[model samples]
Target: MTLLTVRRDGEIAVVTLDNPPVNAISEAVRKGLYEMVGHLDADPEVKAVVLICAGRTFLAGADVSEFGKPPVEPHLPDVVDRIEAAEKPWVAAIHGAALGGGFEIAMGCRFRVAVESAKVGLPEVTLGVIPGASGTVRTPRLAGVEAAVDLVTGGRPMSAGRALKTGLIDAVVSDLESDAVAFARKALGADLPVPASKRPLDQMPEEFWQAALKSASKAGHQAPLRALDSLRFATENGFAEAMAHERETFLDLRGSEEAAALRHVFFAERAAPKPAALKGVEPRPFRTVGVIGGGTMGAGIAGACREAGMEIILIERDAEAVARGLDNMGKIFDGAVKRGKLTQEGRAERMAGVRGSTDYAELAQVDLVIEAVFEEIGVKRAVFAALGRVCRSDAVLATNTSYLDPRAIAEGLPNPERFIGLHFFSPAHIMKLLEIVPTPDTAPDVLATGFALGRALNKVPVRAGICEGFIGNRILKRYRAEAEALVIQGVPIAEIDAAMRDYGFRMGPFEAQDLGGLDIAFLQREGARAAGQEVPETLGDTLVRAGRKGQKTAGGWYDYAEGDRTPQPSAAVTELLAGWTAGSLDLPRTEIAERLVGAMAAEGQAILDEGIAQTPQDIDLVEVHGYGFPRWKGGPMFATGAS
Candidate 1:
């Protein structure tokens, strides 16, 4: 079937885009649109043109499948330009998502109407580019400079209501296509609003302009900064020149390292959740969930579930602990509201979905029960045993253990197939990564449920097989080990951190550990030792044992004096290391970084070799999203050539 078709209805021609899924502005669709526009313009029977789409969404964006390839004729820019220059007025009937180039096309229309649920924006910044094809130029002309900057740089689509308020759309309609047809007739019957390209920019205070530039600058991403510059250019230059600049900036940034890295993330995130075995399986449905702890991780997990509109029951040791856990969950949403991340109504709805319980029997009605208690094997097994008895036989029983063997934890359970690991990183509600660890005997649908939950909570899920630390922490262990090896070989901790920062890591290993608390690693080490497993010793353990538990305790790996957490070289640590008589090998910063990253890559290879992780990209994603491994480097696996 043709990608685009036009049907003339008396004085108005209704053009429909028939692309499946989100109608991507492909070469064929653009050519078809261009031809239809020319045909309708000369027919004389058509007074105005109505552009709408079929099958799910309107033009969502460009056909990303054509990236990094040879260019074809009738590019999106050319099509949108024709749209702007059309003699007959064009009306855009937007529904679902009209984002990136899709929104740009809508902006090219003379008057736009959309369904109430429609969303529109220039979201190119998220893919590491600015809106090409005059979106930056036209959006500012129609929506004013501030809204343009926000819509373009922020890369979030505005709902139809917000779009109407911002003047991005003419009206919010009930029947998208029919209303747009009526809108075209009514519009042609009156004095037309000027085309978006001809509209002037709104004047703003000097501080507002400065503030916009400052916000983009502070974002630390090149795409947003470029978007800000393009919007700013629209104010200073003519519409045509600013549109030229927009196309130029987009093409310039499209091949950039940052853009490439972001695209890698975009694609990797899209592919990460699916495992080979569960390819055809459907996830079991779930409503109410039971969380078996009210500590930080439990509260965060419960908060995330509540945020996903899932009913939650949090289990704690007693009434006071349950109250505290619920209190912590409340504080999280309260903070979200205070920060403008959540509306008061949203907070109230999420809070209302959550309740506290001291009884395991209260979990009988829950569809899924996750144990987010202390990451101890025995404690987790005991929780599962109780869960096995209380929860329905088919309900998923998940352990939130970071490193313990999930298979062993399910040993006592009657239905081992339902037991799996939903390893959420610390500050779980905010973090995006969720490692879905499934034991060998885990039911396919049960495994699918873990991924399903990750989606519900808006997290990136990677399926991992049974292993201590799964994918992220396993590789992180190697990175940490290598860092300690550097410190032991007479590399100053401060110099090591500086080298890693230069290598694009947000913070060096030691600094991150200190921030995460040194006590965490110490406890893990001691736990393994008590279980008769030989754990590699790190300098962090010694420091933790020395009452230097890091940031919370005012110091670890470095000094934090008074009100400063600046991480100065500690004389006490210097004395301790010097007294311990470590071996000397003065390594340069570059060499130190290479050896550390190499060690991590080696461990990642070992993980893949052992089938601990399903794919190299999975390993890369874990390091990138979970551990702050530089996205620009494309994860350790790609950077190290181990993928």
Candidate 2:
């Protein structure tokens, strides 16, 4: 008697979308829902329908595989329309994540009920599209225009509480399906509930719209403005007109090179390699980790380990250094709590897992020891020698050296196969990328363990060969050197920065140099020079020599004043640069920017040619995550189509 299973209890009929994984809205699911809705509409027995999905998630989005293909006979939009026009009251039960088209489907229902842990968003922007199925129109009607604009444009997900506060959902339910059915039944028994389409538009004041536009402009770029405009069309016109506008804008934007590049980056990040050589190898479980040294890198690495639920032992040479490291870590956790990212209880729990020590013997029972001590070869070797004798034979030994040979560090270790490199970026917990370096002597299982640990810590681990600075920083050195040479050729640092920023870099080369501090690079260059390596004399050295050490010193390539972090071009630095290259041919600022891009692209290609990197996509991933390459334009390689 039921085309779709009608397991009715009282007045409620649970219409479950029986799809796997993230319940993607496929053609079959759409057809099934349409037929089920017809049966439910005719049956006087069922007064209300509860729409739910069976999977880890309610619904992820549209089936991406259907993209660019011929449309199915009955599209998901048509199915959503049928649900919206249904005579019986309906409630959507959301669990896990309801995103993109999935969210649109929920929007079409009379009301939505979400679990406490559920997340919701219209993340179509990330996939290079706008929500084509009334999402652009209805979301703004439910939530305010500004809220909808931010969510859709940023493509960021919101927690259940935030969604409820924004009125994206009617209620936060503990048992999503049961509560949804109860709500639907109650609504049916009371009075006919108003459909989402019949709901009056939540109009935005003209002043509010203007203010939002101003704020979005200050935030910079074109996407936010586009989102605002789309919402405006939805609010001003009707839903049908807004949908047509959404489709047109989506198609136009989707075909753009920028969108294509961004799509490439999205896939490229997911393609981050897990070596086949380490397959089926089990990682050793570690409950406790010991970090040798209490320097910035060491402390940051310790913080990252502690954040991942591992007990940490931070050992420094003296009590003062240990106190400073602990204080810094405390400040970091406090900042996290202030940002509302970590609750006080969570922060306390994470802090309790870490312990500081001065004795190396404390590492005796630790499962993994990461030596973030001084980058000196002898210092690392000596620490490894001591650890080899003291720690368990099965414990993995790791070094945090940026450009040192792991093989040389493990030379006298009891088991060289257990030693590897687990390079964490600065402010370790924040940066998502970890370069995992392995020597030939390192066992496959040890390498596998490093990758697994990285995953557990929510870091993308890339397999890197033993080289100077591995992949990211090594290529960065070349790119920065090229930018620096232009400064020596009478090109102003500000001009270079402006050019790169205009070219879609978040910050210009000299601006980034100023922000990162002139001292770090100056000190690094000195070390390279001392090692008989030819050090490139870039603008950084000139600024450092002039006592311009960046924002801390209130001057670098630019002058800074109190309460003003903005950079003002230094006249003296300009005079110095002009004198440094008196006979060199003067070039235009635009040309310098072009040259910088060329240099980055060329170096990326060279790295690929040398097999130093696995793919051009790997280089792109490094640039995007590690170097702050603009996400919308994708990574550098993909942006320029260098590969």
TM per candidate: 0.94, 0.92
Q: Rate the local accuracy (lDDT) of all candidates.
A: 0.85, 0.79
Q: Candidate 1: which stretches are off by over 4 Å?
A: 202-210, 341-345, 579-593
Candidate 2 lDDT for residue 393: 88
Q: How accurate locally is residue 18 in candidate 2, as Cα lDDT from 0 to 100?
A: 64
Number of clashes in model 2? 0
* Candidate 2 global TM-score: 0.92
In the range 1-643, model 1's lDDT, one tens digit per residue, is 8887788777989988998877888888888987887887888788999998998898999888877666688888788879878999999999899988888888888988999988998878777888888878888888888888888888888989998998999999998877888889898879988888777778777898789888876545688999988888888999778878988999999998778777777788888666666788999877999999998999999999988888999999899999999999999999999999999998888888888989999999788998999878888888888888888888888888898888888887988888888999989999999999888888889989998898899899988777778888888888888888788777888888988987878899989988889898789889899989988766777788788888898888888988888888888777766744376667788888889889998998999999988888888888887998877677777877776
Using TM-score as the measure, which candidate wins?
A: 1
* Model 2 spans > 4 angstroms off: 1-6, 67-73, 217-221, 273-279, 536-539, 542-546, 562-564, 582-592
lDDT of 2 at 612: 68
